[model samples]
Target: MKHLTDNTLNEYLDHTSDERSRKSVKDHLNGCDACQTKLEELGKIFAELQIVPEVALKHDLTPGIMTRLNLETPVRIWTRTFAAQAGVASGVLYWLASQLIPFVKIPQVSLSKAVFELQSWFAQLLTIQVSLPTWQIPDIASLLPKFNYQAPTINLPFSTVHVISLTVTVIFLWVVANFILLRSRPQVQR
Candidate 1:
Protein backbone atom coordinates (compact mmCIF):
# COMPACT_ATOMS: atom_id res chain seq x y z
CA MET A 1 0.00 0.00 0.00
CA LYS A 2 1.37 3.40 -1.01
CA HIS A 3 1.30 6.07 1.74
CA LEU A 4 -0.51 9.41 1.07
CA THR A 5 1.60 12.53 0.25
CA ASP A 6 2.11 15.29 2.92
CA ASN A 7 0.06 17.73 0.72
CA THR A 8 -2.89 15.31 0.51
CA LEU A 9 -2.66 14.72 4.28
CA ASN A 10 -2.55 18.51 4.98
CA GLU A 11 -5.55 19.08 2.64
CA TYR A 12 -7.48 16.30 4.45
CA LEU A 13 -6.68 17.85 7.90
CA ASP A 14 -7.83 21.29 6.69
CA HIS A 15 -11.12 19.86 5.26
CA THR A 16 -10.15 21.43 1.85
CA SER A 17 -9.63 18.15 -0.11
CA ASP A 18 -12.21 16.97 -2.76
CA GLU A 19 -14.60 14.13 -1.87
CA ARG A 20 -12.58 11.51 -3.81
CA SER A 21 -9.21 12.76 -2.39
CA ARG A 22 -10.68 12.97 1.15
CA LYS A 23 -11.90 9.39 0.91
CA SER A 24 -8.54 8.13 -0.41
CA VAL A 25 -6.52 10.13 2.21
CA LYS A 26 -8.84 8.95 5.03
CA ASP A 27 -8.56 5.31 3.88
CA HIS A 28 -4.74 5.52 3.67
CA LEU A 29 -4.41 7.34 7.05
CA ASN A 30 -6.67 4.81 8.78
CA GLY A 31 -4.38 1.95 7.62
CA CYS A 32 -1.01 3.85 7.61
CA ASP A 33 0.57 5.05 10.89
CA ALA A 34 3.29 7.25 9.18
CA CYS A 35 0.78 9.36 7.16
CA GLN A 36 -1.44 9.75 10.26
CA THR A 37 1.54 11.08 12.29
CA LYS A 38 2.49 13.50 9.49
CA LEU A 39 -1.11 14.79 9.30
CA GLU A 40 -1.13 15.41 13.09
CA GLU A 41 2.12 17.47 12.76
CA LEU A 42 0.62 19.56 9.90
CA GLY A 43 -2.57 20.08 11.98
CA LYS A 44 -0.50 21.45 14.91
CA ILE A 45 1.33 23.86 12.54
CA PHE A 46 -1.95 25.14 11.08
CA ALA A 47 -3.34 25.65 14.61
CA GLU A 48 -0.26 27.74 15.57
CA LEU A 49 -0.64 29.88 12.44
CA GLN A 50 -4.29 30.56 13.31
CA ILE A 51 -3.28 31.76 16.83
CA VAL A 52 -0.83 34.40 15.32
CA PRO A 53 -2.35 37.85 14.81
CA GLU A 54 -2.48 39.39 11.28
CA VAL A 55 -0.77 42.75 10.90
CA ALA A 56 -2.24 45.71 8.93
CA LEU A 57 -0.05 47.58 6.39
CA LYS A 58 1.06 51.15 7.25
CA HIS A 59 0.53 52.44 3.65
CA ASP A 60 -0.93 51.28 0.33
CA LEU A 61 1.82 49.84 -1.92
CA THR A 62 -0.12 49.38 -5.19
CA PRO A 63 0.89 52.77 -6.75
CA GLY A 64 4.59 52.39 -5.97
CA ILE A 65 4.68 48.83 -7.24
CA MET A 66 2.74 49.68 -10.41
CA THR A 67 5.07 52.64 -11.15
CA ARG A 68 8.15 50.44 -10.71
CA LEU A 69 6.63 47.93 -13.16
CA ASN A 70 5.88 50.78 -15.67
CA LEU A 71 2.15 49.93 -15.57
CA GLU A 72 1.09 53.55 -14.86
CA THR A 73 1.14 56.51 -17.30
CA PRO A 74 2.53 59.94 -16.45
CA VAL A 75 0.47 63.13 -17.02
CA ARG A 76 1.97 66.50 -18.01
CA ILE A 77 0.34 69.64 -16.60
CA TRP A 78 0.72 73.09 -18.27
CA THR A 79 -0.05 76.16 -16.15
CA ARG A 80 -2.05 79.18 -17.36
CA THR A 81 0.92 81.43 -16.64
CA PHE A 82 3.21 79.32 -18.84
CA ALA A 83 0.71 79.39 -21.69
CA ALA A 84 0.27 83.16 -21.42
CA GLN A 85 4.01 83.76 -21.28
CA ALA A 86 4.55 81.61 -24.37
CA GLY A 87 1.82 83.43 -26.28
CA VAL A 88 3.18 86.85 -25.30
CA ALA A 89 6.71 85.84 -26.25
CA SER A 90 5.56 84.56 -29.66
CA GLY A 91 3.61 87.75 -30.31
CA VAL A 92 6.54 89.97 -29.29
CA LEU A 93 8.92 88.06 -31.57
CA TYR A 94 6.50 88.35 -34.47
CA TRP A 95 5.98 92.07 -33.87
CA LEU A 96 9.72 92.71 -33.54
CA ALA A 97 10.50 90.90 -36.82
CA SER A 98 7.67 92.67 -38.67
CA GLN A 99 8.68 96.13 -37.37
CA LEU A 100 12.43 95.58 -37.99
CA ILE A 101 12.04 94.36 -41.61
CA PRO A 102 10.97 97.82 -42.94
CA PHE A 103 13.88 99.50 -41.12
CA VAL A 104 16.55 97.04 -42.39
CA LYS A 105 18.22 98.10 -45.66
CA ILE A 106 18.09 94.99 -47.85
CA PRO A 107 19.10 95.92 -51.41
CA GLN A 108 16.91 94.36 -54.13
CA VAL A 109 19.12 91.74 -55.80
CA SER A 110 18.31 88.80 -58.14
CA LEU A 111 18.32 85.27 -56.57
CA SER A 112 21.20 84.09 -58.86
CA LYS A 113 23.27 87.21 -58.04
CA ALA A 114 22.71 86.78 -54.28
CA VAL A 115 23.76 83.10 -54.43
CA PHE A 116 26.89 84.00 -56.44
CA GLU A 117 27.78 86.77 -53.96
CA LEU A 118 27.38 84.38 -51.02
CA GLN A 119 29.59 81.79 -52.71
CA SER A 120 32.21 84.39 -53.56
CA TRP A 121 32.09 85.72 -49.96
CA PHE A 122 32.74 82.18 -48.64
CA ALA A 123 35.64 81.81 -51.10
CA GLN A 124 37.08 85.15 -49.97
CA LEU A 125 36.85 84.11 -46.26
CA LEU A 126 38.59 80.77 -47.00
CA THR A 127 41.47 82.47 -48.83
CA ILE A 128 44.54 83.66 -46.83
CA GLN A 129 44.00 87.26 -48.03
CA VAL A 130 40.46 87.82 -46.72
CA SER A 131 39.25 91.37 -47.55
CA LEU A 132 36.22 91.91 -45.24
CA PRO A 133 35.37 95.50 -44.30
CA THR A 134 36.35 96.73 -40.81
CA TRP A 135 34.34 99.41 -38.91
CA GLN A 136 36.12 102.06 -36.78
CA ILE A 137 34.18 104.27 -34.33
CA PRO A 138 35.75 107.63 -33.22
CA ASP A 139 36.44 108.04 -29.48
CA ILE A 140 34.01 110.35 -27.67
CA ALA A 141 35.12 112.87 -24.98
CA SER A 142 33.35 113.08 -21.60
CA LEU A 143 31.65 116.51 -21.86
CA LEU A 144 29.59 116.11 -18.66
CA PRO A 145 30.48 113.87 -15.67
CA LYS A 146 26.81 112.90 -15.02
CA PHE A 147 25.89 112.27 -18.69
CA ASN A 148 29.30 110.88 -19.76
CA TYR A 149 28.97 111.74 -23.49
CA GLN A 150 29.56 108.68 -25.71
CA ALA A 151 29.06 107.89 -29.40
CA PRO A 152 29.51 104.36 -30.81
CA THR A 153 28.68 103.40 -34.41
CA ILE A 154 28.93 100.18 -36.44
CA ASN A 155 28.64 100.07 -40.27
CA LEU A 156 28.28 96.82 -42.24
CA PRO A 157 26.57 95.65 -45.44
CA PHE A 158 23.31 93.95 -44.36
CA SER A 159 23.55 90.80 -46.48
CA THR A 160 22.07 87.25 -46.20
CA VAL A 161 24.43 86.60 -43.25
CA HIS A 162 22.82 89.39 -41.16
CA VAL A 163 19.30 88.14 -41.93
CA ILE A 164 20.30 84.54 -41.07
CA SER A 165 21.92 85.74 -37.81
CA LEU A 166 18.79 87.67 -36.79
CA THR A 167 16.53 84.69 -37.58
CA VAL A 168 18.84 82.32 -35.65
CA THR A 169 18.85 84.66 -32.62
CA VAL A 170 15.04 84.76 -32.50
CA ILE A 171 14.77 80.98 -32.85
CA PHE A 172 17.42 80.41 -30.14
CA LEU A 173 15.61 82.72 -27.70
CA TRP A 174 12.27 81.02 -28.36
CA VAL A 175 13.75 77.55 -27.85
CA VAL A 176 15.54 78.55 -24.62
CA ALA A 177 12.49 80.24 -23.09
CA ASN A 178 10.21 77.30 -23.94
CA PHE A 179 12.73 74.82 -22.56
CA ILE A 180 12.90 76.71 -19.25
CA LEU A 181 9.11 76.92 -19.01
CA LEU A 182 8.69 73.22 -19.80
CA ARG A 183 11.16 72.22 -17.05
CA SER A 184 9.26 74.37 -14.54
CA ARG A 185 5.98 72.59 -15.30
CA PRO A 186 4.81 69.72 -13.06
CA GLN A 187 4.42 66.07 -14.04
CA VAL A 188 2.06 63.71 -12.22
CA GLN A 189 2.00 59.89 -12.37
CA ARG A 190 -0.26 57.30 -10.78
Candidate 2:
Protein backbone atom coordinates (compact mmCIF):
# COMPACT_ATOMS: atom_id res chain seq x y z
CA MET A 1 0.00 0.00 0.00
CA LYS A 2 1.18 3.50 -0.87
CA HIS A 3 2.04 5.72 2.14
CA LEU A 4 0.45 9.18 2.63
CA THR A 5 1.81 11.89 0.22
CA ASP A 6 3.21 15.27 1.60
CA ASN A 7 0.28 17.12 -0.06
CA THR A 8 -2.16 14.69 1.60
CA LEU A 9 -0.37 15.14 4.97
CA ASN A 10 -0.39 18.98 4.65
CA GLU A 11 -4.08 19.04 3.68
CA TYR A 12 -4.84 16.68 6.63
CA LEU A 13 -2.88 18.96 9.07
CA ASP A 14 -4.72 22.05 7.72
CA HIS A 15 -8.11 20.27 8.10
CA THR A 16 -8.77 20.99 4.43
CA SER A 17 -8.72 17.38 3.13
CA ASP A 18 -11.88 16.01 1.50
CA GLU A 19 -13.74 13.17 3.38
CA ARG A 20 -12.47 10.44 0.99
CA SER A 21 -8.85 11.79 1.08
CA ARG A 22 -8.97 12.17 4.87
CA LYS A 23 -10.21 8.65 5.25
CA SER A 24 -7.41 7.31 3.00
CA VAL A 25 -4.73 9.31 4.94
CA LYS A 26 -6.12 8.19 8.32
CA ASP A 27 -6.11 4.57 7.20
CA HIS A 28 -2.49 4.91 5.95
CA LEU A 29 -1.37 6.86 9.08
CA ASN A 30 -2.73 4.11 11.34
CA GLY A 31 0.03 1.76 10.13
CA CYS A 32 2.67 4.36 9.03
CA ASP A 33 4.55 6.11 11.87
CA ALA A 34 6.67 8.17 9.36
CA CYS A 35 3.60 9.92 7.83
CA GLN A 36 2.20 10.77 11.31
CA THR A 37 5.58 12.35 12.34
CA LYS A 38 5.74 14.36 9.04
CA LEU A 39 2.17 15.71 9.52
CA GLU A 40 3.00 16.84 13.13
CA GLU A 41 6.23 18.56 11.94
CA LEU A 42 4.38 20.42 9.14
CA GLY A 43 1.64 21.48 11.59
CA LYS A 44 4.29 22.95 14.02
CA ILE A 45 5.97 24.82 11.12
CA PHE A 46 2.59 26.23 9.91
CA ALA A 47 1.76 27.38 13.47
CA GLU A 48 5.15 29.16 13.80
CA LEU A 49 4.73 30.83 10.39
CA GLN A 50 1.24 32.07 11.41
CA ILE A 51 2.67 33.58 14.62
CA VAL A 52 5.66 35.38 12.97
CA PRO A 53 5.57 39.22 13.49
CA GLU A 54 4.35 41.42 10.56
CA VAL A 55 6.95 43.99 9.44
CA ALA A 56 6.20 47.77 9.71
CA LEU A 57 8.06 50.28 7.50
CA LYS A 58 9.57 53.33 9.24
CA HIS A 59 8.89 55.75 6.37
CA ASP A 60 6.15 55.93 3.71
CA LEU A 61 7.60 55.65 0.10
CA THR A 62 4.38 56.79 -1.63
CA PRO A 63 5.50 60.41 -2.07
CA GLY A 64 8.75 59.44 -3.84
CA ILE A 65 6.86 57.17 -6.20
CA MET A 66 4.24 59.88 -6.85
CA THR A 67 6.99 62.45 -7.54
CA ARG A 68 8.72 60.17 -10.11
CA LEU A 69 5.30 59.53 -11.74
CA ASN A 70 4.54 63.34 -11.78
CA LEU A 71 1.09 62.70 -10.33
CA GLU A 72 1.12 64.11 -6.75
CA THR A 73 3.97 66.69 -6.72
CA PRO A 74 2.95 70.25 -7.60
CA VAL A 75 4.97 72.14 -10.25
CA ARG A 76 7.33 74.45 -8.38
CA ILE A 77 7.13 78.23 -8.98
CA TRP A 78 9.56 80.06 -11.32
CA THR A 79 11.76 81.54 -8.55
CA ARG A 80 15.01 81.83 -10.58
CA THR A 81 14.25 85.19 -12.16
CA PHE A 82 17.96 86.15 -11.80
CA ALA A 83 18.98 83.13 -13.91
CA ALA A 84 16.51 84.14 -16.63
CA GLN A 85 17.97 87.64 -16.60
CA ALA A 86 21.50 86.16 -16.91
CA GLY A 87 20.30 84.24 -20.00
CA VAL A 88 19.13 87.55 -21.52
CA ALA A 89 22.52 89.14 -20.64
CA SER A 90 24.29 86.22 -22.31
CA GLY A 91 22.26 86.73 -25.51
CA VAL A 92 23.15 90.43 -25.45
CA LEU A 93 26.87 89.54 -25.01
CA TYR A 94 26.66 87.21 -28.01
CA TRP A 95 25.16 90.01 -30.14
CA LEU A 96 27.86 92.46 -28.91
CA ALA A 97 30.74 90.04 -29.67
CA SER A 98 29.37 89.51 -33.19
CA GLN A 99 29.36 93.29 -33.77
CA LEU A 100 32.59 94.28 -31.87
CA ILE A 101 34.97 91.60 -33.22
CA PRO A 102 37.44 92.92 -35.80
CA PHE A 103 36.82 91.66 -39.40
CA VAL A 104 39.49 89.33 -40.83
CA LYS A 105 39.93 88.86 -44.65
CA ILE A 106 39.14 85.16 -45.19
CA PRO A 107 40.04 83.35 -48.48
CA GLN A 108 36.87 82.25 -50.34
CA VAL A 109 36.71 78.60 -51.52
CA SER A 110 35.27 77.68 -54.99
CA LEU A 111 33.56 74.22 -54.58
CA SER A 112 33.36 73.57 -58.39
CA LYS A 113 37.15 74.01 -58.73
CA ALA A 114 37.77 71.69 -55.73
CA VAL A 115 35.45 69.01 -57.21
CA PHE A 116 37.22 69.23 -60.63
CA GLU A 117 40.67 68.85 -58.95
CA LEU A 118 39.45 65.86 -56.91
CA GLN A 119 37.96 64.20 -60.04
CA SER A 120 41.24 64.74 -62.00
CA TRP A 121 43.31 63.22 -59.12
CA PHE A 122 40.98 60.14 -58.95
CA ALA A 123 41.07 59.74 -62.81
CA GLN A 124 44.94 59.81 -62.72
CA LEU A 125 45.00 57.27 -59.79
CA LEU A 126 42.46 54.69 -61.06
CA THR A 127 41.08 53.96 -64.58
CA ILE A 128 37.29 53.32 -64.33
CA GLN A 129 36.88 52.75 -68.12
CA VAL A 130 36.39 49.05 -69.08
CA SER A 131 38.23 47.47 -72.10
CA LEU A 132 36.39 44.16 -72.58
CA PRO A 133 37.53 41.34 -74.92
CA THR A 134 34.96 40.73 -77.72
CA TRP A 135 31.90 41.08 -75.50
CA GLN A 136 29.78 43.65 -77.41
CA ILE A 137 28.99 45.92 -74.46
CA PRO A 138 25.69 47.72 -74.90
CA ASP A 139 26.02 51.53 -74.51
CA ILE A 140 24.99 52.10 -70.81
CA ALA A 141 24.66 55.86 -71.52
CA SER A 142 21.90 55.08 -74.05
CA LEU A 143 20.32 52.35 -71.87
CA LEU A 144 20.05 54.63 -68.82
CA PRO A 145 18.06 57.87 -68.54
CA LYS A 146 20.11 61.04 -69.31
CA PHE A 147 21.01 62.90 -66.14
CA ASN A 148 22.06 66.62 -66.22
CA TYR A 149 22.90 67.25 -62.53
CA GLN A 150 24.31 70.66 -61.54
CA ALA A 151 24.96 70.80 -57.80
CA PRO A 152 23.35 73.87 -56.20
CA THR A 153 25.87 76.58 -55.18
CA ILE A 154 25.87 76.81 -51.37
CA ASN A 155 27.64 80.00 -50.16
CA LEU A 156 27.68 80.38 -46.37
CA PRO A 157 29.50 83.65 -45.64
CA PHE A 158 29.97 82.93 -41.91
CA SER A 159 32.81 84.90 -40.29
CA THR A 160 34.77 83.77 -37.17
CA VAL A 161 32.78 86.23 -35.00
CA HIS A 162 29.46 84.83 -36.37
CA VAL A 163 30.60 81.26 -35.55
CA ILE A 164 31.73 82.23 -31.99
CA SER A 165 28.52 84.17 -31.31
CA LEU A 166 26.38 81.22 -32.53
CA THR A 167 28.31 78.81 -30.27
CA VAL A 168 28.07 81.12 -27.23
CA THR A 169 24.32 81.67 -27.75
CA VAL A 170 23.65 77.89 -27.92
CA ILE A 171 25.85 77.10 -24.85
CA PHE A 172 24.39 80.01 -22.85
CA LEU A 173 20.78 78.91 -23.52
CA TRP A 174 21.62 75.28 -22.63
CA VAL A 175 23.40 76.19 -19.36
CA VAL A 176 20.62 78.58 -18.28
CA ALA A 177 17.91 75.98 -19.01
CA ASN A 178 19.79 73.33 -17.00
CA PHE A 179 20.30 75.72 -14.06
CA ILE A 180 16.56 76.58 -13.96
CA LEU A 181 15.52 72.89 -14.18
CA LEU A 182 17.93 71.72 -11.44
CA ARG A 183 16.87 74.62 -9.12
CA SER A 184 13.14 74.03 -9.76
CA ARG A 185 12.78 70.44 -8.33
CA PRO A 186 12.12 70.26 -4.55
CA GLN A 187 14.81 68.22 -2.80
CA VAL A 188 13.34 65.16 -1.07
CA GLN A 189 15.01 64.21 2.22
CA ARG A 190 15.69 60.52 2.84
Candidate 3:
Protein backbone atom coordinates (compact mmCIF):
# COMPACT_ATOMS: atom_id res chain seq x y z
CA MET A 1 0.00 0.00 0.00
CA LYS A 2 1.32 3.49 -0.87
CA HIS A 3 1.99 5.76 2.16
CA LEU A 4 0.60 9.37 2.28
CA THR A 5 2.73 11.88 0.30
CA ASP A 6 4.44 14.92 1.97
CA ASN A 7 2.03 17.28 0.14
CA THR A 8 -1.01 15.27 1.38
CA LEU A 9 0.32 15.39 4.97
CA ASN A 10 0.97 19.19 4.71
CA GLU A 11 -2.46 19.84 3.17
CA TYR A 12 -4.14 17.74 5.94
CA LEU A 13 -2.19 19.68 8.64
CA ASP A 14 -3.14 23.06 7.07
CA HIS A 15 -6.86 22.05 6.69
CA THR A 16 -6.51 22.83 3.00
CA SER A 17 -7.26 19.19 1.99
CA ASP A 18 -10.75 18.52 0.53
CA GLU A 19 -13.31 16.58 2.64
CA ARG A 20 -12.71 13.40 0.53
CA SER A 21 -8.88 13.85 0.79
CA ARG A 22 -9.13 14.30 4.62
CA LYS A 23 -11.20 11.14 5.02
CA SER A 24 -8.83 9.10 2.73
CA VAL A 25 -5.70 10.44 4.52
CA LYS A 26 -7.30 9.73 7.95
CA ASP A 27 -8.04 6.09 6.92
CA HIS A 28 -4.45 5.65 5.59
CA LEU A 29 -2.90 7.15 8.73
CA ASN A 30 -4.92 4.83 11.02
CA GLY A 31 -3.42 1.76 9.31
CA CYS A 32 0.08 3.25 8.56
CA ASP A 33 2.41 4.06 11.48
CA ALA A 34 5.04 5.66 9.09
CA CYS A 35 2.45 8.04 7.58
CA GLN A 36 1.10 8.89 11.10
CA THR A 37 4.65 9.81 12.28
CA LYS A 38 5.32 11.93 9.18
CA LEU A 39 2.00 13.81 9.68
CA GLU A 40 2.88 14.48 13.38
CA GLU A 41 6.33 15.81 12.41
CA LEU A 42 4.82 18.14 9.79
CA GLY A 43 2.20 19.38 12.34
CA LYS A 44 4.97 20.15 14.90
CA ILE A 45 6.97 22.06 12.21
CA PHE A 46 3.87 24.06 11.21
CA ALA A 47 3.10 24.94 14.88
CA GLU A 48 6.73 26.10 15.40
CA LEU A 49 6.63 28.22 12.24
CA GLN A 50 3.36 29.89 13.41
CA ILE A 51 5.12 31.10 16.62
CA VAL A 52 8.01 32.78 14.70
CA PRO A 53 7.56 36.58 14.39
CA GLU A 54 7.62 38.25 10.94
CA VAL A 55 10.35 40.91 10.62
CA ALA A 56 9.89 44.18 8.61
CA LEU A 57 12.43 44.96 5.86
CA LYS A 58 15.02 47.62 6.84
CA HIS A 59 15.58 48.93 3.26
CA ASP A 60 13.59 48.92 -0.02
CA LEU A 61 15.53 46.34 -2.09
CA THR A 62 13.24 46.30 -5.21
CA PRO A 63 15.38 48.67 -7.33
CA GLY A 64 18.63 46.86 -6.49
CA ILE A 65 17.05 43.46 -7.17
CA MET A 66 15.52 44.64 -10.48
CA THR A 67 18.84 46.27 -11.50
CA ARG A 68 20.74 43.04 -10.80
CA LEU A 69 18.08 41.02 -12.68
CA ASN A 70 17.95 43.63 -15.49
CA LEU A 71 14.20 42.91 -15.82
CA GLU A 72 12.92 46.49 -15.40
CA THR A 73 15.60 48.21 -17.56
CA PRO A 74 13.85 50.41 -20.15
CA VAL A 75 14.76 50.02 -23.88
CA ARG A 76 16.20 53.07 -25.71
CA ILE A 77 13.22 54.72 -27.47
CA TRP A 78 15.44 56.47 -30.04
CA THR A 79 16.64 53.16 -31.51
CA ARG A 80 13.08 52.17 -32.50
CA THR A 81 12.41 55.70 -33.84
CA PHE A 82 15.65 55.63 -35.85
CA ALA A 83 14.80 52.21 -37.40
CA ALA A 84 11.26 53.42 -38.32
CA GLN A 85 12.65 56.64 -39.84
CA ALA A 86 15.23 54.69 -41.85
CA GLY A 87 12.49 52.41 -43.26
CA VAL A 88 10.37 55.48 -44.21
CA ALA A 89 13.39 57.19 -45.82
CA SER A 90 14.18 54.06 -47.86
CA GLY A 91 10.52 53.86 -49.03
CA VAL A 92 10.61 57.53 -50.10
CA LEU A 93 13.89 56.97 -51.98
CA TYR A 94 12.38 53.94 -53.79
CA TRP A 95 9.29 56.02 -54.75
CA LEU A 96 11.54 58.82 -56.05
CA ALA A 97 13.54 56.27 -58.10
CA SER A 98 10.30 54.84 -59.61
CA GLN A 99 9.03 58.35 -60.53
CA LEU A 100 12.36 59.24 -62.22
CA ILE A 101 12.76 55.90 -64.10
CA PRO A 102 10.41 56.98 -66.93
CA PHE A 103 12.57 60.04 -67.74
CA VAL A 104 15.97 58.25 -67.69
CA LYS A 105 17.07 57.95 -71.35
CA ILE A 106 19.94 55.53 -72.05
CA PRO A 107 21.49 57.11 -75.18
CA GLN A 108 21.59 54.79 -78.22
CA VAL A 109 25.19 54.11 -79.21
CA SER A 110 26.48 52.81 -82.60
CA LEU A 111 28.33 49.45 -82.63
CA SER A 112 31.63 51.25 -83.53
CA LYS A 113 31.23 53.74 -80.62
CA ALA A 114 30.32 50.96 -78.20
CA VAL A 115 33.36 48.89 -79.21
CA PHE A 116 35.65 51.97 -78.92
CA GLU A 117 34.20 52.88 -75.49
CA LEU A 118 34.63 49.26 -74.26
CA GLN A 119 38.26 49.15 -75.56
CA SER A 120 39.00 52.58 -73.98
CA TRP A 121 37.43 51.44 -70.65
CA PHE A 122 39.66 48.27 -70.75
CA ALA A 123 42.76 50.37 -71.60
CA GLN A 124 41.88 52.99 -68.88
CA LEU A 125 42.06 55.81 -71.48
CA LEU A 126 40.55 59.34 -71.40
CA THR A 127 38.16 61.01 -74.00
CA ILE A 128 35.68 58.29 -72.99
CA GLN A 129 32.21 59.68 -73.84
CA VAL A 130 30.55 59.27 -70.43
CA SER A 131 26.93 59.82 -71.51
CA LEU A 132 24.93 59.63 -68.27
CA PRO A 133 21.33 58.37 -68.50
CA THR A 134 19.06 61.44 -68.20
CA TRP A 135 16.40 61.16 -65.43
CA GLN A 136 13.61 63.72 -64.69
CA ILE A 137 11.17 64.16 -61.81
CA PRO A 138 7.59 63.00 -62.70
CA ASP A 139 5.51 65.47 -64.86
CA ILE A 140 6.08 68.37 -62.40
CA ALA A 141 6.56 70.75 -65.38
CA SER A 142 3.20 69.72 -66.94
CA LEU A 143 1.39 69.85 -63.55
CA LEU A 144 2.61 73.42 -62.89
CA PRO A 145 0.71 74.72 -65.99
CA LYS A 146 -2.54 73.02 -64.78
CA PHE A 147 -2.07 74.62 -61.35
CA ASN A 148 -1.53 78.02 -63.09
CA TYR A 149 2.05 78.10 -61.83
CA GLN A 150 4.97 78.79 -64.17
CA ALA A 151 7.89 76.38 -63.46
CA PRO A 152 11.20 78.17 -63.01
CA THR A 153 13.72 77.30 -65.72
CA ILE A 154 17.05 76.61 -64.01
CA ASN A 155 19.83 75.91 -66.54
CA LEU A 156 21.70 73.60 -64.12
CA PRO A 157 23.23 70.76 -66.22
CA PHE A 158 22.23 67.53 -64.42
CA SER A 159 25.13 65.07 -64.32
CA THR A 160 26.44 62.05 -62.35
CA VAL A 161 28.27 64.58 -60.07
CA HIS A 162 24.98 66.32 -59.26
CA VAL A 163 23.27 63.00 -58.41
CA ILE A 164 26.21 61.95 -56.18
CA SER A 165 26.24 65.35 -54.45
CA LEU A 166 22.46 65.22 -53.85
CA THR A 167 22.68 61.66 -52.43
CA VAL A 168 25.62 62.59 -50.11
CA THR A 169 23.77 65.72 -48.90
CA VAL A 170 20.60 63.73 -48.11
CA ILE A 171 22.62 61.07 -46.20
CA PHE A 172 24.50 63.78 -44.24
CA LEU A 173 21.18 65.46 -43.31
CA TRP A 174 19.64 62.10 -42.24
CA VAL A 175 22.67 61.32 -40.02
CA VAL A 176 22.45 64.79 -38.40
CA ALA A 177 18.70 64.40 -37.81
CA ASN A 178 19.16 60.93 -36.19
CA PHE A 179 22.03 62.25 -34.04
CA ILE A 180 19.84 65.14 -32.83
CA LEU A 181 16.93 62.78 -32.14
CA LEU A 182 19.16 60.39 -30.14
CA ARG A 183 20.67 63.25 -28.10
CA SER A 184 17.25 64.83 -27.41
CA ARG A 185 15.80 61.63 -25.88
CA PRO A 186 15.90 61.29 -22.05
CA GLN A 187 18.41 58.77 -20.63
CA VAL A 188 17.05 55.65 -18.92
CA GLN A 189 17.69 55.41 -15.15
CA ARG A 190 19.49 52.35 -13.77
Instruction: List TM-scores for all candidates, in order.
Output: 0.36, 0.33, 0.45
Judged by whole-model lDDT over C-alpha atoms, candidate 3 comes out at 0.73
Candidate 2, residues 118-189, lDDT tens digits: the string is 777566545445455676875645444333334544345789998999999999989987897578655543
For model 3, the superposed segments whose C-alpha errors exceed 4 Å read: 1-20, 30-34, 47-79, 110-115, 121-183, 188-190
Better of 1 and 3 by TM-score: 3
Per-residue alpha-carbon lDDT of candidate 1 for residues 1-190, written as tens digits (9 for 90 to 100): 7888777776777789889988877787789898888888888998998899989999999989876755555543455665787799899989978866666555566788767766765665455343444674433232212321223333345799988998999899989977975685444433
Ranking by lDDT: 3, 2, 1
- Where is the poorest 10-residue window by lDDT in model 2? 145-154
Runs off by more than 4 Å, candidate 2: 14-16, 71-190
Q: Which structure among the candidates has the greatest TM-score? A: 3
**lDDT of candidate 3 over 1-190, digit per residue (tens):** 9988888888898899899999999999999999998888888888998899989999999889966655666665467656887898899889988877666665555778767656655555343344445783454333332221233343446799998999999999889977976675555443
Each prediction's Cα lDDT score? 0.70, 0.72, 0.73
* lDDT for residue 87 in candidate 3, whole number 0-100: 94
Candidate 3 lDDT for residue 165: 96
